[model samples]
Structure formats: structure tokens, C-alpha cells
Target: MSKRLAQRADSRETEIAAVAADALEGRVPAGSLVCGDPDGVVEAALGGPVWNRYAYDGRPAQPWPPEGAFPGAVLRQPRGWGAFAMTLHALAARLPEGAPLWIYGGNDEGVTSIPKRLEGLFGEPETLAIKRRARVLELRRTGAPARGGLEDWREVVSVGDAELVSYPGLFAHGRLDPGTELLLGALPKIYADQSVLDFGCGAGVIAHTVRRRVPEGRLTLLDMDSVALHAARQNVPDAAHVLSDGWSAVPAKRDFDLILSNPPLHRGKEEDFGALEALVRGAKDRLKPRGALIAVVQRSAGVGKLFASVLKNVEALAETPQYQVWRGGV
Candidate 1:
């Protein structure tokens, strides 16, 4: 398994593992929906595929699980508060009356107050278990979900004159990220007819800016996360949107003149740069000769070292206390 999958498997041995195991074995039921799957560990424990579907092609279609289609759902709390709130509301909105929704995570994963968060929608939640430094809570929907507060998590925002659609759980959902802003500010002038790929395009903010700045460039937005891509489509309607885990999923024959990214470095509360490293290591092969790869990465992320290990030359284009934009070409 990859590092991401390995970390998720390791989490299954924690305090709430036994309860989760038991719930997966019987209580959660087959055909129940699973949201925010953590490395397919939950799906494997459930013993088969469940009702897990993702929105496609940056479209808002099926953004939430269908209402009352399943008796219950199992959710792994996301690290972001916006993601957590959105997940909670989405689960509540879809679950049938009296059906249970279970949320599980460790204290270190930043999910200790989930029960409190669910109280308004589901009344007092039931503490299922607390062990091995982890906690599990169950809430049964008794009435329609209280959705009055969910609008905040689903609002679109204006970033540098671009009206970008954002949803909870997307990185920097409501606004532009500083790293992305820095990258946009420092983007080298694009020559005519260049093909640009926005790798890990979150909410299409970078793609939107690139298209505006380089109108002659053909833009393609790619991201592993369906929600991010969905948001991106709204921001850059004219650009192509590709759903991909990494370079592996991109078309083998396609090459780009410019590649851009604000590569993800975190999975929940855990920091893992393997994905970013993979992108850096494989980037040169995907670019045409004289083509460049540009990215905004955290200064402490060792991105310079990663780039230096793979590329002959890596140049720092712009810097802030929190981030830096780096560019390199074959």
C-alpha cells in the first residue's frame, strides 16, 4: 500500500477500532453510504463496495448523497472544520429518520468536539466509545436536517475579480489561498498558443487566473478531489477539467508547455508530501522541451530539495513568510 493507505490502516488499530470494526461488521449495514473514505480502509472493512459516489467533471451533480436512500452512513471526520461541517450536514440531509450516522476519529485528528457540533441537528449525540485515544459518536436523525447554517459552507467568493464557486471540504473554500495568490502574482508571461495544465487545481482559482492572464493558452484543470474539481468547473467554465490522482491518470500522449500547482501536503491532520514529491519527480517527463513547471509550496515543505533532486535547475520566483513560488524547466 502507499503511504496514504498505510496511515489509514494504522488508524484502524486505535481506541475506536474495535467499535468501528463491530459497526462495520453489522451495525452500519451493507449498501450504506460512506463519505470521506480514508484510504479505502472503511470500504475494505465493510467487506465490499458501498454507496460511495463522487461528483464528476466539476459538475455539482450528485454533490451530496441521495436523501433516505440508505439506513445509515459512516463518516471519517475531515481535518478542516469546513469539511467537517459540510460532511455532517450532508450526512444528516441524506439519512432517513431514525437511522444512525456515525462519526469517528482520534483526538489527534482534530475531531473531539464532533458530538457538540452535531447536537443542534440531531439533538444530544450518543457517545459510542472512547478508547485507544480515539472517540466514536452516533447520531440518529429524528427530523429534517437543520440546514439554515449550511449556506455559509457553500457560498461562492470573489478572489481578484474572479467569482469562484466553493464548497465546504475544499481547501481554502471561501477564499484564495496565500500560496495560490503568490503563484498568480508571479506567473511568468505566457507566450501565444501555449498549453497549460493546472495540477491539483483547487476551486479552479489558479486556472481562472491563468486563463485570464494567458488567454491564448489552452488551460486544463486537474485534481484528484471531485469536490475541488466541481468547484473549479464553476470558476473556469471554458477550461478543460480532468479528474486524476496524479500524472498517472493524465493522458499518456498529452504534453504541456506549462504545469502549475499548489500541491496538497496534508491528509487530515497528518502531513505527507509523497504526492507532491511524485508530482515533482514525474513532472519533467510530462513537459515538452523548454516547458516549465511552476508551483506554490510551503517554505518548510522541503519543496526546494524535492525539486533539486529531480530537476537540473529550480528557481524561486516569489516568496512570502508562509510560501514560495518555484519554477523549473527541462
Candidate 2:
């Protein structure tokens, strides 16, 4: 496999995607399978059969298991901050007691001690390790039957007071992001009621904020990453959730009153402003006349200048040495 294609689970979304890919390739088997992190599993080896793991986002994901749904079981883990933590929760719930559970990961990702920590919870592990950063561990767990999953989501202290239900692989492990804070603080004045689309709505913070600010507003949260969208569903319960590459699932010529985002600028290292720029251009089509689009990016990105012709007005609400809040108002 090409090194470029064999991605590591650097983040939660990547982790989910990676594991999904691995399941497809055949690296991980279908029996007694519950990957600690889907993304890691996906990118590991290659696509293979996957089963008995849950990927949850509070609201059920479409095309969710059932269709081509593998036999063992796939479910959403209980609410939590880290994918590892959540995955452990999933395993606790799904694994038959006393029927050993195995967790695998890269050493650079700190898997060496995961087994030790796990042994405390599930009993000592049948462990294995090797160079090139890999470890395999199996815990001898008692079949107490999983107690249950977390009933409620937790709120993060930072990141503009954004709310997130914990899930495996999300950054800050159950909290808000600082970059999001800078963006939210500079959000333009949105009306009390409007049709809004939140692209790349990670864990649904912006969507939740919008819904809270405008109780009657129709909100559509779109994200390509299942884990993010799953979190988005929890984060934006009132909003409609769509899984597609940036607006791909959205209908064209359907206008929105407001579109907000702290759009991501990179995809695993190749700086990708393509989606953001596409939004800058196509967003006009999705906006009712004179509607607005708000965004946050590093100052050096110069996105406003790049899309000057597409937008009627582009201004900076907040600017620092490193970042800028640019609003594209029609």
C-alpha cells in the first residue's frame, strides 16, 4: 500500500475513516471485532470485514448499519471525549464477559501502556508488541454484561462555550477548540429566525449555537466524516444532518439565510482551501439575495482577496498576527 494512502489516525475523523477503510480492505476480521479506533483500523492493512462496533452520533446516521450491515454488530459507543475512551466503552458494552477483548494501535500513538491501563478494567491482557510502532493486546474480561452507556453529553469549558458529547478521536477529548473560539467570538449578527447550513460542523457546536440563538431556524449540519457528523447529530439535535463532502448532499439553488463555519484548511498536510473556496463561490448560489456567509481563517490565507469577485462585501471582524475572521456578505 502506498504510504500516502495508509494514513495514521492523527485525529478522530481520520481515525474513523481509516478504520472503515481497513475493514473494507480485509486487515481486520469480522468475528469478535471491535476496533478501538475506526480510523486506525481502516487505514491499517487494507479493507477487510468489520463487525460488532458501534459508531454513534446521538442521532442515528443514515445508511447506518442494517444495509450491508455486517453480521456481528456495529453500534454507537456511549458518549465521551476521546475515541479511545469511547471505544473502550463500546467494547465494555459489546464484548462477552470473560471472552477476551483485543485492542491494537500504533506505539507512537501511546499504545504501549494502553494494555496496562486496560488490564485494570478488564483484567490482565494477552499482549504483543513489535517495532515500526505497533502493539496488540487482549484483555481477559469478565462477562458482567455491560452496565450501560453515558446518558448525557458534557460541555467543554473553552472554545466559545461550545457543547459536545464525547466520542472517540475528537480533539481536545471532550472540549471545544480554540480556533473555534476565535471564530465564534467574531460571528456576525444573525437573525433570530433563519435557514442556516453549517458546513464542517464538528461536534455540532456552531449548529447548536445557531439553533439556540434562533429557536425557529431550520439548521442543516453537513459533514463528510461520520464521527464528526455523529457528534454533530448530538450537538445539533434540532438540525437536519447530512453526510456528504461539503454541501454535496445539499440541493443546489436552495437558498439559506445564513451559512457559518470555521472551515478546516488542511486534509492531512496538503493545505486544502478548495472546499472553503468552493464555499466562497458556490455559497452565493445557496444564499438568498443579500444573505451572508461567515468564516474564520489564518490571516495569511488571504481568502477574502481570492474570492473578491464572488462576494459583494468581505470584511475582517477580528484580526491577529496569526488569524482573521472574514465575513462574506452578499
Best by lDDT: 1
| Each model's lDDT | 0.72, 0.57
What would the per-residue lDDT of candidate 2 be over residues 65-142, giving only the tens digit for each residue?
Answer: 222322232222222225445455445665545555555444445656665445244777655434343445556555
TM-score for all predictions? 0.86, 0.64
Alpha-carbon runs more than 4 Å astray in model 2:
1-30, 34-81, 98-102, 123-147, 150-176, 224-237, 265-285, 299-312
Model 2 lDDT on a 0 to 1 scale: 0.57
- Model 1, which residues run further than 4 Å from truth? 1-19, 48-62, 66-68, 146-153
TM-score of 1: 0.86
Residues 13-105, candidate 1, lDDT per residue (tens digit)? 333445565555666767777765545556567753343324322322234555555777887666677777676776777666788777778
* 10: Cα error in model 2, Å: 10
